[model samples]
Target: MKKIPETMKALVAYGPGEYKLVTDFPTPDCGPDDIIIKTEGCGICAGDLKCQLGAARFWGDDIQPAYVEPPFIPGHEFLGTVVDKGENVTEYEIGDRLTADQIVPCGECEYCRTGRYWLCEPHNVFGFKNFLNGGMAEYVRYPKTAVLHRVPKGMPLLDALLVEPYGCSKHAVDRAEITNEDFVVISGAGSLGLGMIAYARMKNPAKLVALDILPERLEKAAEFGADVVMNPKGTDVAQKVLEMTGGYGCDVYIEATGHPSSVLQGLKMIRKQGRFIEFSVFAGETSADWSIIGDGKELELRGSQLSPYCFPFVIEHIMNGDLKTAGVVSKTFPLDEWEAAFDCATGKYGDFKIAITF
Candidate 1:
């Protein structure tokens, strides 16, 4: 274990397109049931990039307050070493490798009582609000209420940072309920979608399809295990999917494109009574024909939120080599090169999952 610092550098997000690199931020205090973690690495999630682009959905309008209360550290997907633990804690030891789910629920809510705490009315997500500040800092305190996972000690930080994203994918896949005979189509090849590709393939779907506007991402999707990858920029993706499904449409469709057009596009590619999993955090509101969901096709539309009840599966899959994060985690940067890291992640250099290593 390393000596705890009194103050450390951290990146704070004040609002849309506004940030300050703070070098004198006080180290978080560990509560009786909390543990202090030295951040190893943190990845830039799609939602984080959307915030930098000034998306109204995350930043909010004059009528509504932003989901993220300004001035909080903003990296949600992270891994760390358990540097110190409080007296009440026995699950983690100093120098242990670990990560936590992005949210902490009250546990007294009805949703938590039913084992669905992911949607608890008073739950706090790591990055969205200041009360539950995220992992972009050098050190963070993991409260006992957080859903924590003990990762293997020797796992690479790049791969460990992926657990959060893969856990989200697991929830989406659970909502989709794909089987060996179902034809599945995932409408995004970004990091989250790529993880979905790996998990969906493990389910042995009859036909696994990946669609994206970027040829590079589509190629990576194929490499990650999508049976087929398509670039929608110059093709009628819905028509192609329907034709591939013998004019019926795919049995399951998961939308992670983070684009407004993807919702309706997925609607056109899923068959009657098919399951639709929507997980992307869009920058703006998305509207679709309500009739298509019920009257038109009677599709099963499910909205999957944060990672819940899936961390173990993701950790195991990654550890056993069933799920790989080779090309997915594109690059790593030291904490000082924050802007360059964001630039690379936002496609300045190229679209890749960029992480900041401490």
Candidate 2:
């Protein structure tokens, strides 16, 4: 249809650290199986800058609770088009080009009858609320179980908002099971640790590495494959990965730095039973030495939430050119500046992945 608008530009989140940029906001209602996209590009994550720096797992309590719920409309990575549908939206229509799947499932949990709907259980994390209502905003509403994807059409628009962080880097590199005799690592280079270094270098691992304090994101984590790129500040990144693996350490770490000292530097660079895979989101709480994960090394941690079925496997590796995601969305902003796009998306104003356009 294309003739919808009734109030658009949004940004809400009025609490913890606060935010605001509305310009009439109200514009989302499609329900018969809903659809209504039109967002375009949204990104600004790091869990929306740790729920705007109030993180207690997004502002909760002494035992976790707040999975964000401010004035709503935060942003869940993002991408758009679909302009208006309902009338039983048969798997998307008007103009297509979508991107949903920010959890939302509860389709009668048991993790939605076993497909493990991102571990459903009353979860509903679009921009973190009771249900979908995000994408910084210019209309959003998905509904009918909301698990969209489509997105192909000439990509680029921050590569279709990088299909929501490469579908959370394909579930944190499939829970860090990378092979080729593994050695991995990946701590964090931003933008979901650069899509977990382009899907942990498509499983050819045998070394990979890439820690980051940001030398242009460790030079884009060595052009997204990283054969080694540390900067764990003042070195000793777990004794330089135990002298680059010679003394054994790392065999799949993948934290994605939401920082808590990269979870004690991935519990001192993995290795015993290896396979760490946490995929960060901290803002607090990050101890260490539970005897270095039990008896100075018995690891195998693994946590990675969201992007469950890997949204059509990261939109089929970003529509087949394999996850490079072109120039990692260096920057973009417009929806009324959005506080200078959240001050260049929290990096004060530099270092890629920003998006806000409309």
Candidate 3:
């Protein structure tokens, strides 16, 4: 192994829309219980794009407090090889392939005490906080509190990059509690939405539908799992869903599109007692008729956060060829070309997952 460098290349976020690449950024130090990884690659996510564009949930507003602490690193969907380990770290060693959960829990919070660490009050997600810098750099440090998992030696880079998103997708599908008799609809055929379609298909729902504005993504959704695909540009999605289900609407609707209109569409296309699972991070607040959720229909609404205990399942499936990852990652860019990478991720050039290779 090469000697640890005093400085390394990194992308730091000083504020919303203010990320810069610095070649001389100081490399993170390893604590007694920490481990350092030489990053292989990191995937650019929609949430990262929203944060870059000044999402209220990330930058904060008069109504909600900010979740992000600027002057931080900002890539969470990542994987790498272990290059250094602290004195107290024993479960892993140098040269091991590894990844960690996006959020690091306090372990003493009320939520953590009950095994619901994803809801830890402080909510210190990697890439958003200064202490927990993310994997958009040449290296990353995993603290003692991180939930670490090892990647198989033979796993492909594309399949490895998808574990994080697919884990979240599995969690969202679990929140829906799909049954064999239910008719499910997932709005959005992006990477995360396509993962949801694959996981939902495992439930053997009566009918699985995917909705998207992009025909290409809809086609990928079909290849992944969706039995029916609909484009809202030329069709009234709500009426079409109603017509297909004898005017009762779909039994389950998962909102993966960050657009506000998808929320309204879900409310209109879900049945009276249907379940709705929301997993997207929006750039701003969304408004809707409260009556639609209460008086109009006693619908069940559930919001899913990060992947909690689903990483293991995702890794196992990916290694076993159960999850499809072909064509999911549309492009890859070197760290020096971060600007173009962001543009491609935000749909300037294409509509698929974009990754930054180390």
Q: Against the true structure, what is every candidate's RMSD?
A: 1.5, 17.8, 0.9
Q: Candidate 2 at residue 61, lDDT?
A: 86
* Candidate 1, lDDT over the whole model: 0.87
**For this target, which candidate reaches the highest TM-score against the unseen true structure?**
3
Q: Is 1 or 2 the stronger prediction by TM-score?
A: 1
lDDT per residue as tens, model 3, 206-309: 99999999889989999998999999988999999999999999999999998899999999999998999999988777899989888898999999989999
Clash count for each candidate, listed in order shown: 0, 0, 0
CA lDDT of every candidate: 0.87, 0.79, 0.91
Better of 1 and 3 by TM-score: 3
Model 2, 98-188: lDDT tens digits are 8887776868878789888878888878886725668888878878887777877886777778787778777888887788888888887
Best-fitting candidate, scored by lDDT:
3
Cα lDDT tens digits, model 1, 239-345, are: 99999888999999999987888998899888999998899988777898989999999999899998998999899889899987887889988878888888888
| lDDT over C-alpha atoms for residue 76 of model 1 | 84
Clashes of 3: 0
lDDT score, residue 244, model 1?
89
